[model samples]
Target: MEPRCHSWTHWADEVVLMSDTTSRLLIEDARKALVRRLVSVCGQRDLIEAYVGWILGDKTKEFVDFEAAALASKLRISEPGRTYRDVAVLGFAEHLSPHLDTLYALRKGLDWMLGRRPFLPNREPDFEVDGIALLGMAVGILASGEWEKRKESEKWFIALLAETLRRSRFELWDRSLIYAAQLLITKESTAEREITPDLALALAAKGFISVKEDYERKALELIVNQPNYAEQQVDVVATRLAALNWLMRQVPTVLPNRAAPEDVINLLERVRDSLRRWCWEEKPRVRKAEAVPVKWEILNEYHVQDLLWVILAPIFPDLEDEENLPSLGHKHPRCDLGIPSLRLIIEVKFIYNGTSSEFSRIIEEVASDASLYLSNDSGYDKIIVFVWDNSRRIEQHGELRQGLKKLQGVREAIVVPRPGKMRA
Candidate 1:
């Protein structure tokens, strides 16, 4: 029989069609019809029986009734209740009923097992939705439209599985709840973005993650998929951080703080440090000082501060009387090598074409406020500059080129180009 859902405008086609149509008709009668059509009629019996009790009685949920267990037993094993419930479900599927609870349960049960949790043996005799079928069903259930019963079922399952998997490898969530979560991951809409960094950081405090290390790792993975899952990510990572931080505080179980590999940290830092260059170069250099020898003389960026001072001393050869000028010194904060009066700070940056804006921001922040990089501007005659690899900057508007820009207070600025390495 064709599914009623196909003809019915507002129902799952398979659901409405796989119903148990046995009242005026007999199971024998329906079987013959299906066999003639070459349909296996698999699981149709249970499907039809489940919804039949209600469909015959005004389509209300009140149809979920049961006779006395003692009386039901004498009538034969096909009587109502869980024992012969499978038959009704199969019948419903065969006739293509708009109702389907057995399928939902089967999908949920399979999900619990898939998460590698300890589960009570599903006593139901197996049919189509088993193993691979279960996984496939889970994906469908998750991706399906709004389902209230599904959510409620998932919550109960999660709570139950928590107890079941408490002593198992699936301890992250209750064994019962694993299906619920899988449903969420699978069924949740991709368009509704809610992930964020603050959320990811907070998951450590919430106890969802036992170790900060594990939390960070998983958070990154989750972010790749859900960049905007602000709330859940925070709650999850916060839990992990809380657990990991607690473990760290205990003197005996002490592990190194943030055990992420140094190489990884260095690589990440280099990437971030690279962004500073991008922020600039997109905008024309607004001059705050005279355009001195724009290029700084540097053998390499290793001793960038030393190289900046070396380049500047010749450009602005010191006046004999002005011993109170900002001098070059490695200990100074801003110049990183310049003295009080002779301030000359320079960062060895590898500026890329795409990253000029980012670099501009970093350099601007450092340069805009002299106090930030240089302490006393007694004779702060020069502004610090950092140019990495590429110095050929093209800044223009229409057919006009804005003249070289300058920073206030500083007499001139120099650009130190790092050699060899090139950016595409």
Candidate 2:
């Protein structure tokens, strides 16, 4: 019987290993297919060829020089056939080139272009109306890093991109382009909290799978089946490729190993368990002349929140404390702690005593907070309530937790008793 059990366990382990291998192979295949598609599309247009080369770091000096020469000729002749929009694309491509001379020329060209239509905050710029041009200029400015040189041309370009992202509708492809540029500039810190969900929705609308789930596979699909070679389609495909590459390098995979809502609940349970053994006694000690115990205690909701924040910060770098929720009607609600990346809000409750009245009030307060928070545009999808019951009412905890769980958006409720021997 022992031999048979060992054989069965070994067989299960092999099966699990094989499953993981298969999944990895599928992911690799999907990535390769996307790269192949991108390469094929890059051949269709010079602008895309240059832009993608810059994005993928496949730029060749010979090709950059040739592209630069062509753009310079167009600018010099003031090509009757070329509109200012075309000049913007040329400027974008020129910036992607490695030549210093081309960059200087491109700066002058941008100055002329801006003279035609200066940056006006209130008025919509022509580039904003033209998604391809907008992205072209934005990407060009970023690739050149001229904005760092304190150049007015690049500064204006940055301002334009920032305003475009701020003002554009989330549903529009323009917003996605500007958001992608923003991501490239900030390297995924500044705008991620606000734009990620909207970007996912936009990608979904384009028939790509949710960016939150299986983005690599869906992004491959979007690139391979890029319906047309129209300028707008090219811009969209290019933006998607750039965004995908950035995600692959800088962002963690949202796959089989990504943390889920359940993992957060488990973490909270661990936190609660750790708090059980908190301090030498009910209060923390200071090793002065002797081990002097301070009167510091988890006295209120803020105290509970601060303790939780210290424990959670090392784990979640993006954790926010006292994050304000959108105002609903006349009431302004604030979350005790929020993990933006997880879209999880944590509300800490401190019950002075585990009395029935106190428990009832917690239920009502949690319920009210839930309605306001979940219904807001704050982007949090779930809530976890952490309750510190100082009254040691372990009996009422089960009922209180159950009642809190029933509230909408309350993913889990944790009730932790004050450590034994701690003065209430």
Candidate 3:
């Protein structure tokens, strides 16, 4: 019996060893294949960069800049209002002598890959090369082509991302991929608008080219795991609050007279508008210092309240001097903004994502808080719910607006600044 047991154990160990060995062999095979593919592309690996450098004669300017400068020079040198044919002859790409055919092919491949085809100057290409050589060259050309088209607006997003990477502690590969994906998605959009993961996924659904998968996956991963950029700005917040407190104390008589409840509601709207504008700024303030700002994944309800109290309280007189009015009923309810004269309470909810479940949760919390504030009868008259949809998560907040309208004392359900439009 002992011998049989030992033999069975030995057999199991052998099986485990075989599995490990098989996995290692497979990994090695994949590594070898990747190496061979890379080797095949070695000859033309730097061709695009070299060609661009040669054409520009300066390493500082990007390919797009070179193209733009060349085109502008052609326009200057050409006869006034030349025909389309004459203009074509003066094109930047037309003047390039080295591998002109290859450059054209590169641009064509880029257009095809970027979903820019079926537009203008479309061409047919010979399927000449395979493996990494073709793909490697194609990738560089695509980047240059996309940049040429999107350089103006795309820089803001890139610079923003670069600044964020400099400020944060994200890994090297993670930051690089994140920056690349952001640049790609920004170029993909027709409006030249900011991008999110869901937008990237939607763009992918609309049929982007081969490399789209890599970028889409990276963008999605980034959205899911976007680092929490909101560091506690204790010193800054405290300083600002102290300044506000002092200013408020000095001008106690300047508090706006308590008017109808509608006035308070309007005040909340203004606050919401201010926050939305701040959120959409080219360099959204993630930290106290405005030097290196980032957008999204940072400001929370507390930050919103802090900002509101400081900004709104000064203008609106009826706003309570105290911060975070305590509710007598349940421990869960807290008033972020309170109006003593009108008995109005304003709650700000920051929208993070567009998921139905997330929206549902937000709705549930608002409803519960509304019930709590009204339940206490501690002079709280109306609850104005401000949903800060910075991410444009609440697309068509009609249903949400309607649902919030049904809640008791909920005067207005405002999705701040509405989506896509912000006051500059």
Candidate 4:
């Protein structure tokens, strides 16, 4: 036989054709019959039952009718009365009810769980909302193989489990253990998230292989084998920095101090040393009886900034390089390296072939850079100049250093060895 309320559209149209009083009476009667039939139906019924019950005067039997033992036996509840099974039922009803708003139902359901409302349905709920909500959340957990998405449900379940355990007082075969286990295993069909004592003990009993080492090995393989980029011109240093940062984040537990500035600098120095040791172009040898002068390969300020980025990323993920100085009511100067967290500013200067003009210009530039850095209200505590003397031409280095030190906010100036100098 065809279901009477199967075609809601036809029913709705027929209702509209009836007189107002007659239509209201018909709707009220149909709702009453639906609610009565719902109580009799068994084995995973729709959440629509709750919506219908609420609409048809939300009247239902109270827990007084249910003997805890009988209820436990019938529903296979391991520990009866230990959990707010009614809340789970309501949440399920809300989730599945087309007529009920999801969030509204959730709020109402949570209110019952939190004891804000002393009772749900003004008595015994038509269905266990809490159980069904947990079951549904378990389905999500199993499908995603993650615990975070079901965080709200998990939190409630843990609290419920805790309360049940407390009431049972850790007794063997108690309702608390049974209820908690049932909730955990509710919808876990494949046993993917099963936390049984046997399984835990079995895992602990076995000798486990180091999976992390294998994962790292594969990662290293990819890093070494893969080209920097498949297409277009990509900066090699930038690519290397990105790969290194990814490795750090992926295995943060293995790293000494993840995201610490000094730790980042240490990592950077390792890369810098490797690059200086192997990546630089070597000078050509002169033939016998031939006089040929060889100039050292010099790296510009921008290239040096890229090298700084390799070390800075682990500590200061937000560290800015070549950032434009804030317009502090003067000509806007650009920073070579600026660590906002440390309030530290670094200016990099490289003198090529050390001519008198070049020497004078770079010295003046460092002094001006210090002046600009100090004048700005960027709240920088220290400014340091790193000068790479490629030509080794500066005589009386102490006097030149003193001149730079005289500038306001200027800290100690240091001359760094070039890659070519290190090669020698």
Candidate 5:
């Protein structure tokens, strides 16, 4: 049997991936704010996942270890299947521009080989590519020409596949293509042009293909004639087709005499809206209860948010100052770990909850084994629970204030357990 890939996760180290200190600080504050808002809205504080998931449309772990390992082995050798190393080397192919050409290069090879379309790879060694399924998805969106439905399906497929990749870890997951196949049917509607012939010609000069037919041809050519090498590959190609089919149904809008660019774009959006509408109508909504995720991953503090920046920032000046760091801001931007860094972190509780003790214990554990915790971040500096009593009840419950005071490291812990309570 081939050896397994590394068992560690990129998210395991909290601070390494961030671009800079500002990004780290912003993420920290965003994390807390997200938690706080979640608590107030859902009657519980730890609902950040649900909130963000809703926005990201419930993307879950998609890639499996077996899939990674299989792909990894194939990566070292010249082959059809994409490997984990291939994906990593792509350096975030979907989002980054440099990776776009690499992604296209992979697609070209797969497209040519399967279609017998005569593509040469320049025959370089160690030149693995992005997952074909993923590239198909991008093509569905970017190259989708006259088919609105296909365009929509492509979007759905991409989102689903991206989510799958995000969740794939070291453990062997069910490496199935069922979900991948379903992406095409979910939302494909149609492809319509947004630019006038004049503006379109300009965009074309700028490398944007504005004509619907041109896009359709490109999208189709990518998937057409590729023999079903594997069920996974086949499904991906089918999914791409589904997105294209949706695009075919869409009615292209024509530009009126001297139509403004914005107007043309708006007209184009109508086509996209039509695509989504058709997709929604196509799916048979499951009335059954959602199968509870038995193994729902609970992202620890460090995995979800950077914890290394917490302790070391206090000791080492100029620790987290970099250009690309995402700030701790989600709903509201707060905290800057630059120039003036945070000496201590604080958490405020609306109702007197048991979380204060939990926070204290976690912090103390980290502080006790500073080297161990610092080496591999174990989430959070120290948990300090502060109770804000909006309703008059602090005096009614005398023990609340006393409990906050006893939590070890709390500087000025308070329990305004009264109606007219206001203290910072």
Candidate 6:
């Protein structure tokens, strides 16, 4: 029996080792696939920089190569009139170079790009490319403190960037670059203001972009079907590489997990508090100098349910209202609000009077509802009861809540008083 026990322990250890080995092999295979794709699409300078950036972060040797290439290309341009497209090149070079010549070139390029200097008659701007070039130029100017001396130009540059971001139908690579640049600018701004809305919108936009598709799986599909990178456009190839680089950097990091049961309870409690505030603070009617004030009231449970739906729907994107439950014997019941993702059901209750019997009836009704709502087959595992006490029975709330919590499947019980001001 001791030998058998030892054999079982040895088998479990072997299984654990095999599992770890399999995970490592899968990760290594994925890394190799990404590297191969990067190698095949090394034609563009940005593509090369992206590949190097992924592998070495900021210490990549391609930065030196990129600087040399930029300087060489700038030297070949004989005519000052043709330097409009050099904005990105000069901007990047300015970031790298300490010399006065690179700064002069970036200024010239910015002038042409921003239309302070006239372009040659035939050079209609590709606004998408221009947007990307402007992003690079902004980085250079910010790095060099050029924006400190030219406040008006800085304003124009920011306006142009904003307009371009708003109007341009850029591909994924250009769009991502613009979004990332905007995020960085917002982060580094010194202005005293509320930046949460701006930051939230930017993050929401980034999340929307990243979650639109399984990019790694899509990249693998492209690799299998289109073996020849020569056939694809340079921009398309760069976009694919950029996406894979993003995937590689992001895949290892974990996002915040879904809302837990405790979090949902806390959120519902906040909602309950908000309802009380609304009841107490909201003016019942607008009084004219000579006219009588009109009356307003939360007349029924449906009104409370509707208000709760309005409050909770935005918080939980998949919140279902009036979701029907399967029949239990002769009675059919519907949950007021259901968050399927959290496996939570919220039932709204309204009391007409402050009578003890009415409060007792609420406890009984909630107890019965709990059994009907929660079952082995039902998807929902937790229930929250929100009671709006229109009769303003603040005294009975503790008893009501205690009674509700004693019932099976009831995770939270919130009892809010109707505003005493409404009695006037």
**RMSD of each predicted structure:** 29.1, 16.6, 24.8, 27.1, 25.5, 23.2
> In candidate 6, what residue range of length 10 has the lowest lDDT sum?
1-10
Best by lDDT, which number?
A: 2
Give the per-residue lDDT of model 3 (tens digit) for 279-357. Answer: 4456645566546643433346665566667765665554653333222222424567866434567788876666788
C-alpha TM-score for every candidate? 0.20, 0.47, 0.34, 0.32, 0.19, 0.39
**lDDT digits (tens) for residues 157-273 of candidate 4:** 555544433433322212212342344434233222222221111111111101123233332333333332233111221222222233333333435443333443354335435
lDDT of 1 by residue, 299-407 (tens): 3345443533444444332211112222122121223333221233233333344255645554465454454333322223344334333444433111111111244
By TM-score, the candidates rank as 2, 6, 3, 4, 1, 5
Which residue pairs clash in candidate 6?
none
Clashes of each: 108, 0, 1, 10, 50, 0
Task: Please provide, for model 6 over 214-286, each residue's C-alpha lDDT reduced to its tens digit, 9 standing for 90 to 100.
Answer: 2234343343234465555433443443443443343212224444567657766776446444544343355
lDDT of 4 at 274: 61
Between candidates 2 and 6, the TM-score winner: 2
For model 1, the superposed segments whose C-alpha errors exceed 4 Å read 1-303, 309-332, 339-354, 373-386, 391-406, 416-424
Q: Put down candidate 5 lDDT per residue, 362-422, tens digits, no spaces.
A: 3454333232211111111222333334344544335554544455444334333322212
How well does model 3 score by local distance difference test? Answer: 0.41
Q: Candidate 6: deviation at residue 74, Å?
A: 76
- What candidate 6 gets wrong by more than 4 Å, as runs, is 1-257, 272-296
* Window of ten residues with lowest summed lDDT in model 3: 1-10
Tens-digit per-residue lDDT, 295-401, candidate 2: 55777888888888877776665567876554443355678897655678899998885678889999999998888777523457789999988888899988998
lDDT of each: 0.30, 0.56, 0.41, 0.40, 0.29, 0.53
Which is the winner by lDDT between candidate 1 and candidate 3?
A: 3
TM-score for candidate 2, please give it.
Answer: 0.47
How many backbone collisions does model 4 have? Answer: 10
Alpha carbon lDDT at 149, candidate 2: 43
